[model samples]
Target: MSTDTALQVHSLKQSVDALSEKVDRNHSDLLAAVGKKKKNKDEGDENEERGNWGSKIDFFLSCLGYAVGLGNVWRFPYLCYRNGGGAFFIPYTIMLGLVGIPIFFLELSLGQFTSSGPATCWKFAQLFRGIGLGMVIVSSLVAVYYNMIIGWAFYYLFASFTSKLPWSECGDWSSAYCLDRLPLMENCTMRNWTATVNGTCLNGNGTLMALYNETLSKETMGIKRKLPSEEYLNNVVLGSGFSDGIGDLGPVRWQLVLCLLLAWIFVAATLSKGVKSSGKVVYVTATFPYIVLIILLIRGVLLDGYQKGIEFYITPNLDRLYDARVWKDAAVQIFFSLSASWGGLIALSSYNKFHNDAFRDALLVSLGNCLTSLFAGFVIFSYLGFLSTDLNMPIEDVAEKGPTLTFVVYPFAVTKMPISPLWAILFFIMLVTLGVDSEFVLVETVTTSIMDMFPQTRKYKTFTVVTCCAVFFLLGLTLTTNGGLYMLDLMDTYAGGWNVLVISVCECIAISLVYGVRRFLNDIECMIGRKVCGFIPWVIIKYWWAACWVFITPFAVTCVMVFSWYDYTRLDGYPLWADALGWLMTFVVILGIFIPAIIYLCITPGTCGQKLRILTNPLVEWGPALVKHRRLVARYVPNYVVDPWGKEDQNGIAPSDIAVEMQKQDAPGYTPSPEYYAQKM
Candidate 1:
C-alpha cells in the first residue's frame, strides 16, 4: 500500500473513534436528563393525583356499563328475532370468539400497558397514529346522536310521572287517522282505495269513505289505521312534521332541547373529575339497569301471551343461516355490542392500575355483555307477546327496532298492564340508566384522550369534561329539531358503520403485523405473565390470540366491510345531497388514517427505508407505564429495540441476538439493559 493512503486510512479511523466517544457522552447526558425529568414528573403525578378507577370493581362495572348498552335492550332482541331466532347465536358466538374477545383483550392490554388514550398510545407505531385520530372523531359523532336518544328517554321518563301515560289515549298529538281500537267492520272487505270507490267504511287511505247512501258499507273496509301511540311518538316526541327532510330541518322542539340539556348535564356532572368521578358513578348507572331488567322480566312473564313471544325469539330457523346478511348482521351486532374499535374500552382500561389483570376483566366484561343481551331478549320478547295478545295482533306486527321499540311500542305495551303508569315509569327509568352509562363513558373516552395528548389539562379535569360535554350538547341540538331523527339516522349509518370495520382491520394489522405479533406477545407476557388466577390460562397470549390477531380478525372484519359495501342501498326518501354528506363523513375518517401517514413520511429526515424502519419501531417510552415493571420487559425485549442510539438499530444487531446477550450478560462494555437504566430512572 502507498504510504499516503495508509495515513489517510489511519486519520479516518481516528475521526470515527472520536465521533463515537462524543456520541457516548451525549447519550449519557441524555439519559441523565431523562431520568431527572422522570423523577420530577413522578412527583408531580402524585401531587396532581392521576385519575384511576376507585377499585377493581369500579373498573369492572365501568367496562360492563359501557359494553352492555341500550343495544342490548332494543337492537339485539330484534336481530335475534329476525335472523333465524336462536340460530343467529351461532354466527354471533363464532364472531365473538374469533373477533370480539381477541380485539377486546388487545385494546384493554394496550391501554393498560401504555397508560395512554387511543390517540397517544400509537407511539409503538407512529405511522398508525391516524387510527387514534379516527377513533376520536367516530366517538365524537356517536356522542352527538347518542345523547339525543338519551334525551328522548328523558322526555318519556318525565311524561311517565303523570297519572296517565300521554301515549295511552293520545291527547293533543292525535290526528284524525289515530285509531285507539279497531273498528267494527266485520262485514266489510278490506281493499285498495280508489277515487271511484265511495262507501261509509274506513278506506285503506287512512280516511273515512262515503257511500251514495252515506251509510257504512263493506266496500270501504279497506281503510287504513294508525295507533295513538305511534301518533304520540311522531308528533309529540319527534315532531317529525316540522322538517320536510334532512335538507330542511325545521324549528327545534324546546321541550326536547331541554331534555337533551338535562342529559348532558348529568353526563358532565358524572365525569367532572374524570374517571375518578366516573368510576363511582358507574356503580349505580351500571347496576341499576340490571335490577330494572330483572323486575321487568318478572312482570312480563306473568302476562298472558309471553310464552309465545319467548318461542318466537328462540325458535331457530336453520335455513336463515344460508343468507350472508345474517352473518354480517351477527358480526356487526357483536362488534357494536361489545363496543370494540370505539376507543371506550381503551380509555376505560387506561385508568386501571398497571398489572390489574386486564385479561380477567376482558373475559368478564365480554361474557357479561353477551349474557345481558340474551337475558334482555327474554324480557323484551315476553313483553312483545303480551302486547300481541292485548292488541290481538300477530307477534310479527308487535316487534320493532330502535326508537319505535323503546319509546313507542314499549310505552304502549306498558299501558296494557294493571297499574300502567307505575310500569311506564320503571321502563323509562331503566332506559335512562342504561343510556346514561354509555353516554358518560363515551364522553370519558373523549376527555381522557384529550388529557392524554395534553398533559397540562389533567389538572383541570372538571373544566375539560364540561367543555367537551357542552360542545357535544351544542352539536346535538340539531338532532332535537323536527328533522333531527333523519339526520341522526344518516349519521348513525355512515359515521359508525363501515368506517368502524375499516378501522378494526387497520388496528389488527398495525398491532399484529407491523408491530410483530411475537414482540407484542412478549410484552403481554411481561405484564400479566403466563397464568392468571393461579390456574386459568391467559389463552389470549397463546396460539389462539396469535392466530386471531394475525389472520382471523383482520380477514373477518374485512369480509364484513365487503359485504356491507355489496349490500349498500341508498337510504330511501333521502336527498342525493344527504347521501353525499354521509359519504363525505365516511371518507373524512378513512383519510384520517392516510393523510397523517403521508405527512409523517414527508417530514421524517431519513432515506425512505430508514424512515420506514423508524416509523415501525416502538418508542423508547413504549414499555410498561411504570419503570418498575420494565425490568421484566427488558428481560424479554432488548432495550436497544426502543432506544434509537442502541446498537440494535445502528449495528444491524438482531433482536434475537440481543436477547441472548441479555440472558448471558457477557457484553464487552456497558450494556443498556432495563436493570442498568431503571436504577437511574
Candidate 2:
C-alpha cells in the first residue's frame, strides 16, 4: 500500500479503538448504577429483615418520653387547678378512658403495623395522609414554641448562679440586673424630663432636683429602707411586675438568648446521630420527670398546708360532673394532655419495629402519662397550699394560670422552702430537659418526613429543620416579652388548645371511618405477631373514639369560637391579625387531611403504569374524587407495601394474603398434614 493509504488506515484504527473504549466505559457505568441500586436494596432488605425490631425497653421508654413532657409537670396541674381543682380528674379520667387511651392505641398500632412515619402510615391506610402531615406540621409548630420555653428554663438555670435568689429578689435594680442591663442602669434610672411630675420632690422652686445628693446616695438610702422591711419589700415585689422591680441590666434577656442557643446546640447534637441518639436520650428524658415528681411530691406533702392542697386537688364535687360542658372540657383536656390521636405519637410510633407490642405499650404509656399528670397536680397543689398559708392568701388566689404557676407561684413556693436555690435549679433543669427532648423529637419527625419525601434534598433537610426551629424561636422571643402574655393566651387558646383537640378527633375519625377500623385492627394483630384482645376492637371502634369525636370536638370548637368572637367584638385590644392567623392555622389543619387522600385516590389508576408516582410527592394534586379512587384501589391492593424507591407498590401481594398467612402460622391447627398436601396437588 501507498504511504497516504497507510496513514489513513492508522487514523481509522485509532478512531475504532477510541470508540471501543467509550463503549466499555458506558457499559461499566450502567453496571455501576445497577450495582448501586442492588446494594441499596440489600441494605434496605437487611434493615427490614432486622424487622420491626427494637429493644422492647427502648421502645417503651421512647413512647413514654414522647408522651410525658413539660405539659405534664407545668401545664397539667395548673389546668386541673383552674378547671375545678380535684373535680377535673373525674372528667379527665373519663376522657382518658374513652378518648385518650383509644386514640393512643390507634396511633401506636397504625405506626408499628405500617412501619412508617405519620405521613406514610396514613398513606398506608389508603387514607388522606394530609391529616398525618397536619399532625407533623402542628408538632413542628409546637416544637418551635416549645423549644423557646425550654430556652427560658435554660435562661433560669444560667441565672441561678449569678443572682442571690434569682426567683425572690425585689427592687428596681432586680429587673435591670435580670435583664443584663448593668451598663444602662444609670440611663434608665434618669428621670424623664418629658414626664409631668407634680410632687414636693420636684423642688420648692418647681425646678427638678435630685431626690438625694447623688444617684448613688438615693440608691443606698432606698436600699436601706427596703432592707429592714424585706417582707414588705417582697410583697411589693409580688404586686409589681418583675420588670418594674429589676434594673434593666439583669441577665434575663442574656439568659433567654443563652437558653435559645443552648437548646439549639443540645437539640442539634442529640439529633445529629438521628434515632440512636434520640432513643438513648429518651431513656433518661422519660424517667427523670417522674423522679422530679417523686421528690417534689415528698417535699410538697410534708409542708404545713399539704392537706389543704390535697383537698383542693381531690375535692371532687359530683355537681361538676352533672354538666355535660364540664365533661366536654375534661375530654378536651385529656386529648390535649395525652396528645393521643395526634400525628406526633403516630409519627413517632411509626419508627417502632413491626413486631413491637405497641398495643400494650400504648396502654402503659397513656396510663403512665395520666398518672404523672395526676401526681404532678398533687405536687403543685401541695406547694400552692404552702404558698397560700405563708402569704396569708386564699388557695384560690395563690392557685393561678399555667404561666403564673410556673413563673410566679411555683417560684414563690421554692423561695419559702429551705435551701430553695438548689430546688429551683433542679426544677428548672428538669423542665429544660423534658421540654427540649419533646421539642427536638417533634422537629425531627417533620424533618424525617421531609427527607423521606425528597431524598434528593436529604443533605439540606437538617439545615431546613434547624432554620425552621430558629424562626420559631424568634417568634417565641416576641411572646416572651412583658406584654407577650396576651398574645400567648390567644395562641394557646385558639391555636394550641382547641385547635389541637379538634384536629386529633378528626384524625381518629379519618382513620376509623375512611380506612375501615376492622382492617386496621387486623393489620395491627398481624404486624405484632399476636391477636389483639377483643376489648380494643369493641371500645375503639364501637364507642370510645366515635363518641368523643362526635361530642367533645364540636363542643370545644364551639366554646373557642364563641370566646374568640366575643373577644373580637368586645375586647378593645383584641388582635384581629392574631385571630386571622389562628383561623388560618385551623383551616390548614382541617383541610390538610383530605388533600393528600384525594390526590392519592385520583391518580392511583394511572399510577400503576407510572409506577414512580408517590403519595408524598408535593407535585401530586389531591381532590375528593381522587381519594375515592384510592379507596377503591386499596380494597384490592396492599397499599402499605413500598417498592425499592420508597414509592407505595399497590400491585404487591394483597395485605389480606399476608394476613391469611400470618393466621395460618399462628393458628393452633396449622400443622402441615400429608393428606392436605395430597388434596392440594
Candidate 3:
C-alpha cells in the first residue's frame, strides 16, 4: 500500500475509535439516568409502603404551630363575643367534639397514611386530588392576602416606634404638630401668611396666625364619653377617615411594603430548609403569640374596669342561646377558628414522618389553640370593659368590629393607660409575629404541595415558591388601597368564611365514607402502635358526626350567603350584576373543594384501599405470625426474612405476584410461608 493511503487509514481508525468512545459514554449516562429513575420509583414505593407514624415531639409542635395561627387570636374571640358571649361555648364545644376533633384526626390520619400532601392525599381517598388542589389554591390565595395583613401588622409595629402614640392618632387636621394634617396645614399657612409681592402684609395675621390651631384644653379631650363618633373613626379605628388617604398611599404605604418584604424574608428563612427547619422554627413562632397573649391578659385584667370587659365576654344572656342564629354562629366560629378542613392541616401533616403520633398531637394542639383563644378573649374583653367605663358608655358602644377592635378600640384602651405607646408597640408586635407564623405555614403548604406534585422541579422549588409568594404580595397591593377593607371583607366572607366550613364538612365525609372509618382507625392504631378502643369513631362516622356536619355545614354556609346578599343589597350600593358576580364567586370558591373531591372519588375508588394495604398489610401479615412462630421459625428462617416475609418474596417472585397467589388460595401472605406452602400443597 502507498504511504499516504496508510496514513489515511490510521486517521479513519482514530476517528472511528473516538466516535465509539462517545457512544459508550452516552450509553453509560443514559443507563445511569434510568437507574436514577428506578431508584426514585423504588424510594417512592418504600415511602408508600411505610405506615403512618407520629412525629417527634418537636415535629408535632411545629405541626401544631401551623394549625394554631392568627385565627385563634384575632378572629376567634370576636366570634365568641358575637355568638352569645360565653354561651357560645355550648355549641362551640359540641362542634369541637363532633366536627373539629374528628376532622382534625381524620385529616392527620389521611396525610400520614398516604404520606402525601393535601393534593395527593385526596387521591388516596378516591377523591379528586383537585379538591386537594383547589384547597391548596384557595389556601395560597388566602395566604397571599393573609400575609398582606401580617405586613400591615408589621408596618404598624414599626410605626409605633416613630409615632407619639400608634393607635390613638386622631384624623384632626387642625392640630399643628400632628403628622396627618401637616401637609394641608403647611400649604394653608404658607399661602396665607407669606408676605406678598404687593409689599403689604399678606395676611393681617402673621405666619403663625395662618397656621390652624386646636384649642387644647381638658374639656376638648378630657373624658369624652361613649367612644369616638363613627365620623372620627377610620377603618383602622371605625371613624370616618379617608379610606384611601395619604396613610395608605404615603408613609404608611412604604411601611406596609416594608412589612411585606419582612414577611417574605421571615417565611423564606423559616421554610427554606424544609420540615426539619420549619418544625424547629415553629416551636418559637407558634408559641410566641401565646406569650404575648399572656402578657396582654395580665396587663388587661389588672387594669381597673377590666372585670367589666370580662363580664361583657362571659356574661351569658340566656335569651341569645335560644336564637338559632347564635347556635349557627358558634358552629361557624368553631370551624373557622380551628382551621380544620382548610388543607393547611393536611399539608402540614403530610410532612410528618411515618410513625409520628398525630392523634395525641392533634388533641393537644386543638386544646392549646382553644385555651389561647379563650385567654385572648379575656384579655380583649377586659380592656373593652375598661374602655366602656372610661367612656361611660355601654360595652356594646365601646366595642368595635374586627380590624377596628385591633387598631382602634385596643389602641384607645392602651392610650387611656400610662405609657400607651410602649403597650401599643408590644401589642402590634405580638400581632405581627402571630400573623407571620400562621401566614408562613399557609404559604409553605402551597409551596410543599406544588413541589410534591412536580418533583422534577425539586431543584428550583424554593425559588419558584418564593417567586409565587412575591407575586401574591404584589397582587395584595390592591388590598392596601382605599377600597382594601371592602375587598378584605368580601374575600374573608366569601372565600375564607363560608367556603372553609363547607370544605371541612365535605372533607370529613370523604374520609369517613369513602376511605371508611375502620381503615382510618387502623391507620391510627398503626401509627401509635395501640388500638383506638371506643365507640367514638363509630359514632362519628356512622350517625352523629356526619349528621351534624351535614346539617351545620350548609346552614353555616347559607348564613354567610344571606348576610352577604343582605349587605350588598341593603348597604353596599352594588348593582344586580355585582350581586350575581358575588354569588358566582361564592359558588366557585366552595365548589373548588367539592368538585375535585367528586371527580377524585369517581376516578380512583381503589386509592384509599391501596394506601390502607400499604400501611396495615405489613403488620397484619407478619406481626402476629412472627410472634406465633418466634421459637419455631428461627431454626428454619432468619428473623429479618421472617419479620418481613410478607413484604419480601422468599423465592425470586415479585411480592405482588405472591400477594395475588395468596389471595387466590384464600390465605394471608404470611400464613402461606414457603415451608408451609410446600408441605400443604
lDDT of each: 0.81, 0.59, 0.60
Q: What's the ranking of the predictions by lDDT, best on top? A: 1, 3, 2
Candidate 3, residue 473: Cα displacement in angstroms equals: 1.2
Give the alpha carbon lDDT tens digit for every residue of 84-152 in model 3. 788888877776776667677767766765566777665434344456766776676677677767776
Ranking by TM-score: 1, 3, 2
Q: TM-score per candidate, in order?
A: 0.84, 0.68, 0.68
2 or 3, which is superior by lDDT?
3
Candidate number with greatest TM-score? 1
lDDT of 1 by residue, 1-681 (tens): 899999999987876676566558645755565456556544433212355676789889989999988999999999999999999999999999988999999999888877888888998889999998888888888899998998998898888898887888747667755655434332345544333344444567756543322222333554444567788888888888556889888988999999999999999998897777888888888999999999999999999999999999999999999999999999999888998998888888887766678778888899899999999999999989988887676787679888878877788888887898899888888888898888877888889889888989988988999999999999999999889989999998888888888888989999999999888877776667778655677664477788999999999999988999999999999999999999998988889877889999999989999999999888877765544455567776755334333434445332322232222333223355535533433
Question: RMSDs, each prediction?
Answer: 12.4, 14.9, 15.3
Higher-TM-score candidate of 1 and 2: 1
